[model samples]
Target chain A: MSQTVTKKLMLFFPKCECEKPIIYHLVKDHNLIVNIYRAKVTPEEEGYLVLDVTGTEQDIQRAMDFVRTFNVTINTTGKGVTWDEHRCTHCGQCLPRCPTKALHFADQATRQVVFDEAECIECLACIRVCPFNACASAF
Target chain B: MKTYEQINDRIESGKAVVLTADEIMDYVDKKGVAAAAQEVDVVTTATFGPMCSSGCFLNFGHSKPKIRMSEAWVEDVLVYAGIAAVDVYLGATQLRHGDPANMYYPGEFRYGGGHVIEDLVAGKTLQLFALSYGTDEYPRREIRTYFTIHDLNQAIMVNPRNCYQNYNVAVNDSDRTIYTYLGILEPGRKNATYCSAGQLSPLLNDPYYETIGVGTRVWLAGAQGHVYAEGTQHAGDCERTGNGVPMEGAGTLALTADMKQMRPEFVRGVSLRGYGVSLALGVGVPIPILNEEVLQRTCVRDRDILAPVVDYSVDYPQKTGRVIRYANYEELRSGEIEIEGKKVAVGSLSSYCKALEIANRLADEIRRGEFLVSRPIAPLPRHAKMKPLVIREK
Candidate 1:
């Protein structure tokens, strides 16, 4: 039985590394599903891609090792989505906009929209959908 | 049966038994309605949501040269300056000059009169520009100045229509998604959006504006206010149940409060992505326990209130009034409702937590002898029909 795992990651590409088809190699070679929420890979410019890489645990590890050869940096920090708790009114207006239940009510009692960074794929849907501007993009 | 004067006496003496609409249900469930009625003197209800009919009337202290302002713009958003020389009515949903509304297709609608209201209340400096066609008494033709909340003589929030008895559950059944004042509705009934506080709502508790009427003191955005009149388009004679709860948008109130005493957090500026800007304000009405019948009505549970599910993409906009189904607050709060045997998610635009906070605050104020409930000198209309407008050649 293959153990499937999905990792939320930010891949920082150096100026010299943007030319390579790194995402293509991950899909064609490692057979991973890369759902890119945001990408800024430009020629001669340092860029980053906030994405979700899903595949078997073994294949994802192999893909990470392959990307290391290009002098690219991999970070697991959830800094892409900026949410201010003070501004959140807990109206649940951002419920349907979220692909995942990243922003959802903690429980029926309080009915507050709590932020779960682990579940966030950096889709940034809650940023603009929130009428209160409680959610924003850090980038 | 108790009287409004009796309740006020109890409030003044610090002997009143005050509870929130949500809290009253527990009391009634424990002690029964008849017993609870004699013990509980008041029940406070509240709702906080986007009310587009809300706005503020401001009187800017006259300028040095004095200009009879015909046109005024605050933070690039136009304000109705026809009231007087320095007075302006800043509507909540008014867009900025050259807003390019929906031209961007799902426009961000970043700034508007709503944001300006929030900024002013937050004590931020705002630029005001006025134009006049040169008057003799007020000789200035144009003037540009900056002012803050303190600079204005008066900033009063006057909402012409607010606190609908009930609202529809918006759904989009079309192939494409639609953006509306109700928020974003997903295509093919993927999700539903509702905008009411349900059982804790003021009109739902009172049913027929029994205690919430003209001259009735209310908690308006953290300050005291009064119900001045019936709200615009108030269709009080809507479909109802045996419990007297309106099944659709019904009785409403025109409320006013001095914005100087209001907190900025209670009056928030909201920006719907594709739709225009609107203000989300907090309003709480105290329903005095005049009799056992009043106590029983205030004990309305979430299951008792039903909201009609209307498709915003077609039914609502086309005025066909097609209802897919009726779901109570219980089902809506459960986060899912069955549509065509498929479980579709649901959400609400109103903040139940904020409403609860306001209700609790009002209850505390009444308990501490700081707030008192009063009967209306003039009752709201019980049978007012909303009229539709049609273009005609007179």
Candidate 2:
């Protein structure tokens, strides 16, 4: 039984090295699913790619290791979404925008909204809905 | 009915039991209005919403040659310095240099005067520039310097208007989403945006403006403040409900508070998408329940406080039959409300969390004897009327 999990990964590519097919090697060699959440790839200097890497525990580890062999730095950040509590006013304005109910009001007495990242599908609904832009990708 | 003096005495003697507006209804329901009126000495009401009519007056002590500052800017945002030589009034809604109105394109209002005030209060060094014509006695012409809020001799937020009694509910009847200070209301009544804390709002609870008046002690941005005057647009002469609460916009409060004691959490700079910037203010007012009528009034619920749902797509200042429907905050806060036929999602610009927090904090302060309730020096006018301006041949 293969257990699959989603994770946020940042892949840094070296300058003037656009020809390197780093993602191809991870999928073909390591058999990992790569979903680019955000990317800044260009024909210029250093570039960064925020990705949702999904596969079995062993294969995902090997995929990250395989990318490192190509001189690509990888940093595993967070699961679904990360909320900056300081920036969040807990306005609860984004509560209705959440389809998955991952973002919810924690206390009826206080009406303060709390985020459960595990339930967040990484659909970026909270990011677009938040008035304060407090919810952001963990990567 | 007990007088305001008797209520203050009860508060001082620790015989006053304080409850938030949200908590008052249940207490009254259990103990009955008559018993609760005698038992509950105060009902603390609060609201945390974007109030655009917010700013501060800063007194920059003095410079070398005592230049009269004709023009002053804090963090690239210009402040009105016409009042005094060294004093400046920085409004929260003032835009930065060359910011497009973006009525059609609708870009984010990234930063403005509100953010500058927040940064200053956060102890961040702000780039300040002032220009003045060189006077014979005061030789200095201009100065570009850096100063924090602490560097200023006085930083007082004397908002001409802060707490609005009631506001219109915003809805978009058009096909596209319209950005406004009322928060974003989606197209075709897809969503509704309301900006009051319902029962917890001070003006909503004290609908008739009985307890809330001039010199009323309030919890302002986490600091002790007072209602100083009638607000700029005090529409006292409006259609009222049977309970004496105005059906539309009504009384407003001019608030004054010291900037030194304010908390950053309570005061936030809000960017209202396409509209502009506004200060997300947290204000809490404690009403001393002097009689059964006061207790009953404080027991008003979210469903009882009604506001007209207005379509924002209507042209400038023209009421093109924009009021589609009337809905209370209870229906608005229920995630969705039935408008025409579609189930419209509802959003509130008011931070109910922060409002509750302020109310609770103030209650705690009162319980600890750190805060005291004060009587209003003057009651609000009962017959004030708002007149519209029109062009005429002078």
Candidate 3:
């Protein structure tokens, strides 16, 4: 078995399994270390949880496969970032807020702001500074 | 020495050579100021930044009964009333009535007076409403309807203050980030942002106001405009560096331009997070190189224009002795600088790229004889002093 690895993920539970205590099973049965950063759950509706899970590579893969048996969707990506072209004024307001150089002016002549998703640390600083609410994230 | 008339004649005949402040520096460095003065007829300077005092006057066509508007709103943002019966001045910083009042974590300012003005200039129809007390002659109490910039009798942007000569650099020392009109300032001096475009700025190059004054034509928001008066908060008297540029805020311009000719690219709406709404305006002024002294003044470079970084977390004008020391625009634009043993990143409120575009475009207009240069009807006063307010115990 490989060494323990940590991964941040988002788990979505459909309405059919909203009442099931999947987190309890992950902790007791699987013996996985989990830290829930955010959770939104309702008795009769879909639910979501953002968590950091730590376990052996094989154990983590098995745990995710087991989650699929409950009809729950798991995404290992931390968060999703999207830019609304219609709303963004290309004013470059969010350029400085980004700690990483993921966002910058495209070139000298156009001076339009562009975002490179690969370089983004997903700190959401751009979302806060954007005056037009152009930068949005899915958590 | 070239006279204003001679320069005007040259411009009219398409013979006057124009260069940007940066280009002028190269010309002057290659040949001395005297020779450059003989070769270059004009040097252009420009700045593009958020100017809060920007606004426009709109004359809504007379209603059935002209209402002396006591209260006015454009797209839910309040505008200045008490002007003429039908005229209203829409200020850029005015927030909508529905906007959140929170200062720290206030949400985005999606739309406001600035957007409304921009929409009007773009030939879009906007809702205009006004309430007033009914009178004998003008008995209309309230009016609400859509008004386009074309339908309005007149639309003119007469900003009380536009271009600032040299502004301070903003930095934060607190543990938490602070959102200010200067933009988002990171905590622990992680970043520093300055406003002016340094040597490319018009007023900074003409530090003493020798050539720029009332009636001087400038490239305002991609349109031709003229300086009307000395701007509000005009600080002619201030400490200066050896180069004669003010170490603090100094001269400003009260400008006026027709709204019909403005381009949207040059007019941008900005929201300073916690602060309020403002308009990013592009302005370019041409300096006629009449003598070698004027040419030398216009040749100042980014390395020589120094500005002090100030802590904006505290109350301003009262937070004395908070300056970290002066840094030139060249250092500030380097993206990171060591200050007090810490590496602090840098940002800018003024767009150097846009300023360069405006300067080049203005030079092109002059070279093609499409734009006319005007002499100032009256020179700006040089002895004016800015005084600080003191709170005295009663």
Candidate 4:
């Protein structure tokens, strides 16, 4: 029997003020798992959050493309990327940027983008091309 | 203005006037006292916690051992009063000479830690004063002298007070004798236990120089602010005395007694500030100002007088650790000798030795002078015309 290895991915969001339930729903609706950590806040800088995830490389890439459909920025470290709301414009231009066809627009009533942390491969291709500067990596 | 040489000559001839407490008061009461007091730049106060009575007992696994404790005595008080500068001096000296191992441990044991003269001298330029007291048929005369360094580059005068009084004076080495001064500030009863000195953790462990997480309460009293801390002792607790007198249920008695001893006249006006240390690093030495220029130019680094001399090491914890120690004779002499490297000859080893000897003799001479009567007041004069001025401009 062959053993399968899963890569760990981490994501960070700087200065997030949204309630925990809303953040959980944004991730759960997309079937993604993430662990949150807080960063030290200095006088000159804003607060930030970090998330760790584990998934296959292909699944991670698929997840990155999927989160982009809702206009949420994403960057991957290991296999996951952060989505910052401050820089997010909710523009759907990045939906066509993902090659895996994982992203799709959600209901207009909900202003959140669906994200699967498990499906991020940390390729950083979508992050580099992100014009909003909302996406960042743990690294 | 007298030159340094003239002052040195007067001190050498035993012609320097020893200012009595009354004379000091009178001098200050005069118009020029502030200017005279300005000559005093450095005032070093060091608190020496009693040595651990259990010598090497903990190292040998003797956990619970009874130790004979000595009377907690105030070691020495160093004051840089005037005449440019003089070395620190003490009236009484007690020297314990024996095998270091038997006292501290086996083998050659050096008194390495708990002397912080360098830290005390960090920003101040002052001479080291060594004073010793003596008693004989000619009269109980305290001798004053100075130090003159020899080729050894360092001379450790063990218990300079005891050496001069008992050993040096007996050998008629008065010329080489260190000067002595009667204590202006006398040792009082050990009345208060602010907290056990042992309770203080080493300085390095404390990040903020504050005690952390220990539910110790501190009482801080400020002139413009209300009392910061107050508490009651447990009932039935007894107050311990320096003379071994113990009184039961003496709540707040310890502080009251200490206040009474420290200032008997104005006990009511004395205020106190106390706080608990989650981590205590002992008391800090106030920075010495060698001159007005030095006072104005010097900057505070790490809330200490001297900058870090060398990096902290476990062996040399005073330098490395947060806690600074008092400087011994050996350390001061070494520092004086090292000054030669800077191309400054304040005095030779013999000269230094003589300075201390002369200081001790001067102290004795001052003590022998006729005591003056009458209390002296501050020199600041109140002028009739020096009323509050109010100006009205059209």
On lDDT, the candidate that comes out on top is: 1
* Per-residue alpha-carbon lDDT of candidate 4 for residues B99-125, written as tens digits (9 for 90 to 100): 133243112211111111211112222
TM-score: the better of candidates 2 and 3: 2
TM-score of each prediction: 0.92, 0.92, 0.84, 0.17
True contacts kept of 1: 0.77
* Local distance difference test, each candidate: 0.89, 0.80, 0.83, 0.24
DockQ for candidate 1:
0.64
- Residue B6 displacement (Å), model 4: 31
Q: Which residue window of length 10 is worst by lDDT in model 2 chain B?
A: B315-324
Any runs in candidate 1 off by more than 4 Å, and if so which?
A1-17, A20-37, A44-46, A51-78
Give the chain A TM-score for each candidate.
Answer: 0.79, 0.71, 0.63, 0.38
lDDT of each residue in B301-381, candidate 2, tens digit only: 887778888888773236564567778877877778887788888777888888888888888777666777777899877
Residues A5-114 of candidate 3: C-alpha lDDT, one tens digit per residue: 88877888898888888888888877789987568788788888877789888778888888999999988864656677655555555676787878887773445567
Chain A TM-score of candidate 4 vs. true chain A: 0.38
lDDT of 1 by residue, B268-378 (tens): 898997999999989999999999988889989999999999999988888997899899999998888998798888878999988998999889999999988878989
Per-prediction share of native contacts kept:
0.77, 0.58, 0.21, 0.00
Better of 2 and 4 by TM-score: 2
CA shift at A103, candidate 1, in angstroms?
A: 1.4
Q: For model 2, what is the error of residue B198's alpha carbon versus the real structure, in angstroms, after optimal superposition?
A: 0.5
Clashes in model 2: which pairs? none
